[model samples]
Each structure stands twice: as C-alpha cells, then as structure tokens.
Target: MIQITNLHKSYKTGSNSLHVLKGINFSVKEGELVSIMGSSGSGKSTLLNILGMLDEADTGSYVLDGVTIKNLNEKQAARYRNKFLGFIFQSFNLISYKSALDNVALPLYYQGMARGERMDRAMAYLEKVGLADWSGHLPNQLSGGQKQRVAIARALASDPKVLLADEPTGALDTKTSYEVMDLIQQINDEGRTILVVTHENDIAHMTKRIVNLKDGLIIEDTPVQQVRALENV
Candidate 1:
C-alpha cells in the first residue's frame, strides 16, 4: 500500500543544513501494523510527517496507495492525505471547546461530507472506541485516556486507508496504554495500515513489526518477536 525508496529530507539552518532523514527506505503493506522506534531528535516524527504528506521529502520516491506523492501540489497533496490517511497524536490535538462527537466530525466536515452522514459516522466510530456515551463531553472534561480514545475515534471517522499515529500511548498510564494499544491492534485487524511512531519499546512491541531508527536511518527492522528473542539471547 505504501512504498518509499531512498527518501531524504533536510532543513536549512542559516549557513548549515541539518539532515533529518538520510536515504530512508521501507514499504508498509496494506493491513500491516508497523512501529517506528527512535529516540528524541532521531527523525521519527519527520518521517511520519513525510509519510502523512504534511511535509515533502527533499529527494527520493514515495508511492502511497499507488499514487506518487513527491511532486504533488499543495492542494493535490491535501486531497490525497485527507482521503487516504488518518492521524492520532500523543497530545490529543482536540479543540478545547468541541465535544467528542464534534471533534470526531471535524475531519469529515473538512472533506465536505454532509452533516448528517458525518455525525453518523463519527458516532459509529466513537462507539467502536467505547466512547459513544461520552459524545457530549468536551476535551477538558475527559481524562487523558478518554481524550485519546476520542482522538482515535476522530481518526477512524475519516475512514482513511492508513492510520499514522505519533506516540499514541505516551501520556497514559500502563493500563490505559495497553487498552489504547489493544484498540490500535483491533483497528489494524480490520484491514487498515497502521504506522505508529513511538520511543517506548513496550509500545513498539505491541505492533507486528518494529523499525529502529538512529541518526536518521533505519538500524534494524524486524518482527517484534524476533527483536525480543534476539534480546533474550
């Protein structure tokens, strides 16, 4: 579903150029759940941004769901991203004043979905995330895990082909983290491609495959079981 080759990205810092991604290469098949594990300043978020089409790569190729994204214009990129990707972030990125349902419905509204249809879809996803009863609660009223569930519902409400999550369980307690991870696993089981970026090894292990990154390059990419087995050797 997603193919990237020799991807490179850099930022200009006055007279010096800071390289954020150095020829990264990987492919994520449709319905596969992949985790990217990296330390701070390791370019995981930069990679996620590129994958989400929020930022363009400086060089190399990226074909997402059969569409090449390197040269897409802003409007074209936005259209592809809106139609093909959903995002969950650690910060819960919800509007403070909006209720859970309203937050979930926002993306559909951006896509010009009819109000009735969007609300229905939002409510359905909220129910899937076990937040249906809390639809009227605003962000501030919900606990961290609850807010994260609302974010997950919001992500799914778009019905996108790929889910890109950045540190999704970072802010929650262990139990809540596991609960959220279980929801992510369930979502992946339903045939959606999930790529999560996290610094936590345990969280990364929850996914089928983990890609370890350091100094802007993938150092190891393996199934989670293999990683654990090797660690125990």
Candidate 2:
C-alpha cells in the first residue's frame, strides 16, 4: 500500500546540513505489519514522518494506496492525510480535559461528522479496543495501557487505510506492553496496514517484518517468524 524510492531528507543546522534519510527505498503491501527499527540518529522518525505525510522528503517518490504523494499544497495534503492515514504516538496526545469518548470522537469531528454519528462511531471503536466501560474517564484517570488503548481507538475511529504508530508500547511495563502489542497484532490480523517505528527489539519482533536503519539508510529488511505478544503476556 506504500511505495518509496530514492527518498532523501536533510535539515540545515547553522552552516552545516544534517542528512537524515539517504536513498531509502521500500514498499509495504496491504495487510502487512512492518516495523522500522533504528537507534538514535538512524533516521527512522524521518522516514515515518515522510510516510505519514507530516514532512516532505527533499527528493524521492512516495505513493500511498495508488495516490502519488508529492508537492501537494497544505490543504490538499491535510485532506489526503485525513482520508488515508491514522496515527498513534507514544505521548497519547489526548487533551487533558477531554474524556476518552470525546478524545476518540475528535477526528470524526474534523471530518465534519455530526455529533450523534461521531459518538456512535467513536464508541464502537472504543468497544473494539475494550475501553467501552471507561469512556467517561479522562486520560489522567486511566493507566498507561488504558490511555494507549484509548489512543488506538481514536486512531481507528476515522477508519483510515493505514495506521502509523511511533514508539507504541514504549512507556508501559512489560506485561502492559505485551497486552498493547497483542491488540496491535490482532488489528493487523484483521487486515489493517500498520507501520510501527520503534527501536526495541522485542517490539520489532512482534511485527511481521523489520527494516533496520543505520546512518540514514536501510541496512537490512527481512521477514521473520512472528512473535505473538499474547504468549509473552
């Protein structure tokens, strides 16, 4: 569902330029769960940002679900991003005052969905994530895993084509992390295209494929035997 070729990205720092991604190439098919693995300064976040259309590449080609992604105006990019992409961040990005239900309903609000319909959709996703009973709870009221589950529900409420997760499970204890990963694996098994950006080996192993990045380039891309997080949990 994603294709990239000769992707290059750089940032100017004073008089010097820091190259972030160099000659990156890869493709993710529909229904695949992939992880981008790298250490600090390895360009994984840069690649994920480009893939999510949150940032533009200096040069290269990116096609998402048959649409070429390049040179779009801000309005056009936002429209496409809303229609095709969903994101989960490590920070949970929820408004402090918003309840879990309200948080999940926020994206549908941006889509111009009416309150009644949006609430119904958001509740359905919250139910799917096993958080229906906690709908009235705020982020601070929930545990880290519960907050991440709310975030996952929010990400899915829009029904986007691909899910882009950055450091999912990074902040939780081992058991909670495994529980979150189990949910993610279940989502992928149901045919959602997911790309997780993470540095943890166990986290990467939970995905079907791992793309290792080093010094702004992909050093290794390979499929591996999947590790079921449920077993670990």
Candidate 3:
C-alpha cells in the first residue's frame, strides 16, 4: 500500500528550475495493479523514482506499508528499499557476465544471505517466471522478453512488498510485450501490489487503474475494466 499527498519536486538547471511534480496526490491499496501514464516530461519517471526511494521529493509526504518515507539517511533508505520494494526496468539491468541464476541471486547476495538459501530462493523465483530451464544462460544469450523475465524473477527473488516496473515492455515487440504483461497480470492476481510506469495506452489498459499525468500533475485517476493481455496477444 502507498499513500502520497501534495508531492512537489523540482530540479535546478543553472538559473532556471524545472518543476517535475506538482501537488501530486494518490494512494494505491494492496492487491491493486496500477499504471501511471504520461508522455515524456510528464513527471511519471520522477514520481516513480520518488516512490522507489531512489530520489527524494522536494516537499510532500509518502507512506509505504505504514512507514513514513522522508528525510532518511542513505543507510536507512537503502534498508527500507531492500525490505519493502522491488524494481523492474526496461533496460533489463542484468550484468553481462552473470548467468540468469546468478543475476536473480544478486539481490539476496546483497542481503547477506548464504549461498544455499540464496540459490534456493533464486531458483524458485526463476521457476515462477518460467525461466528455470534457462538458468545457466547469460543476458546476451537470451531474447529481450526472456531477459525481462529474468529481471522480473530477480525483482521477486527478494520477496518485497511492492513491485515497481518502469516501462517494463518498452523494448520488446508487441507480441513479447503482451507476454510480459500477461506475466505481470498473473503476478498481480496472486495479490502483490504492482505499479507500472508506462506511456503506452495498451500497456496502461492492462492495469486495473490508470493515473494520467500531464505537466507534472495527475489529471485523471480512474479504475477501469482490466484488459487481458493474453486476449490481445
């Protein structure tokens, strides 16, 4: 669950300031799949970064699963991030030399988990993502969709409370994107709160709710009939 109110953020460029988010307010409940939709420069990325605790808001309040998020030291922020959030990026962020299994296991490795337990958890998630058979394959060895699946597995391996995906299917073909979205929908059905930041209409429609952002503010936030990606595929 997430609650944000009156969020405001800006960046300074020499003598001018670029305002990224303005008076943003929203809440996402548990078991909900939501998409933040916006064009480039609409502040969706800024909002996602703030939500992921990768960046700080200039002003406002953010509450994640009952914990207030504000003014924390780097160490404290990192601890909360590891304990509560997981991320999936469009770029697939995997190490070129690491096998799929090793890539999935990296987060657990950061948590100081032992090799045996880490491998066990990693394999379980890889299997969950239907990538168990490809565990030994490296990123370059896999296709775009396959790499994204591996990224999804890696994000879930840590068992975080919320999954944050930014342009999750941006780099894939339409068919592959549908497949990836189907997996995301299935994961949401199992009751994990998922927030996707995307500009594609079809991608946003796959989610239960869509929050449309324009010029750094939410213009529309509404629930809609969930679009099944498999049907579209």
Candidate 4:
C-alpha cells in the first residue's frame, strides 16, 4: 500500500516558482487498480514521477509500502524504486535493437539476477502479456500493440508490488488501446496494484477507482464497482 500526505512539489524556472503539486493526499491499497485522470498541466505526471521516486517533492511526506521516501538518499531511493515500483510509458520505451525477451530481461539484469533465472522469468512474463510468440522480434518488427505489450512485460519483469503507467494508450488505435488496457486489467486481477495516469475516460473507467487532479490538487476521489477484468474485449 502507498500513502501520501501534504505532498507539495515545486520547480523554479528562472525567477518564477512553478508549483506542480500542492498538498496531494491519497492512498492506494494493495491489489487495487486506481486511475488518475487529469488534463494538461494538471500535475498528474509530476505526481507519478514523485510516486515512482524519480523526482523528489519539496515538502510533505510520501510513504510507499511503509517506507518514508522523504528521508531516503539517492542511492536508497534508487534501491527502493527498483524493488517496489514498475513503470509503463506511452512511448513504449524499449530498446530498438533488443528482442522482446531481452527487453523484459533488462530489469532483472539490473536487479543482478543470474542470466538463466532472469531469462526464465522474462519468458514467463512475456507469455503472460501475450507476447511469447514475439519474444524474438525486435521492437520495429512489432505493431504498436505488440510494442506496448512488450513494455507491459518489461514493467512486470521486475515483479514489483506497484505498477505506475502514464498515458499507456495514447499512441495506439482504439482496438489496440483496448487490448493493452485489457492486459493491464489481467495483471491487476493477479493482485498487483496499478496506478495509471490517463486522459481517456474509457481507460479510467476500467480501473476500480478514479482520482481526478486539477491545478496540483486532488479534486475528486471515488471508487467505482469492480469491473470485469480483461473482459472488455
């Protein structure tokens, strides 16, 4: 589970102070799929980055799975992030030259797992995301949907407790978007908590909960009925 309170983050541009996050307070329970919806400049991505431990907030507190990130040093933050968080991006951040299997195995490699074990785990996750047949294919050889699936597999490769995805379906067509969303839902059903930031309402509806952000504050938080996972197809 993750808890954040009075979380404030700001940036300095020349002589102006840009307040991106203003006292964000929210909690994400274990195994819950939560969607964060916001418009441009709503600070959703900033909040996600802070939650992902890639950016530090200037004030307030963030407790992820019981550890306070406000006090962690750079190395400590890196270690904790590697251990507890997985990320999916709209761009499908994959190494163009690496095969899908190798792309998934990259995280495990960073975790220092043995090559054999890492390869095994990567292959398993690839199958889980319906990319087993494309394991040997390069990113360019795959379709947009396949690339996103590989990204999802890479995110799951680390076996993190939480998966944070940003605009996951932004680059794909409607059908492919639905497919990617379905795959993410399946992962959530398997008990991995997911917090996704998306501008698409339909995509947000797939999640069990919705949190809306505006002007750096949480304007609305509501829980919807649990929808059928991977049944949207």
Which scores greater on lDDT, model 1 or model 2?
Answer: 2
Query: Candidate 3: which pairs clash?
Result: none
Candidate 1 residues 4-64, lDDT tens each?
8999999999999999999999999999999998888888989999999999999999999
Q: What is the C-alpha local distance difference test score of candidate 2?
A: 0.94
Separately for all candidates shown, the number of backbone clashes (residues 3 or more apart, or on different chains) is 0, 0, 0, 0
| Positional deviation of residue 7's Cα in model 1 after best superposition, in angstroms | 0.8
Residue ranges of candidate 1 with Cα displaced over 4 Å = 226-233
TM-score (C-alpha, index-matched) for candidate 1: 0.94
C-alpha RMSD by candidate, in order: 3.4, 0.7, 0.7, 1.3
Candidate 4 structure quality by residue, lDDT tens digits, 1-233: 99999999999999999999989999999999999999999999999999999898898888888988876788898789889999999999999999999999999998999999999999999998888998999999999999999999899989898999999999999878888888888888889999989999888998999999999999999998765535666
Scored by lDDT, model 4 comes in at 0.91
* TM-score, predicted candidate 4 vs. hidden true structure: 0.96
lDDT tens per residue, model 2, 85-142: 9999999899999999999999999999999999999999999999999999999999
- For each candidate, give its TM-score against the true structure: 0.94, 0.99, 0.99, 0.96
TM-score-wise, the better of 1 and 2 is 2
**Regions more than 4 Å wrong, model 3:** none
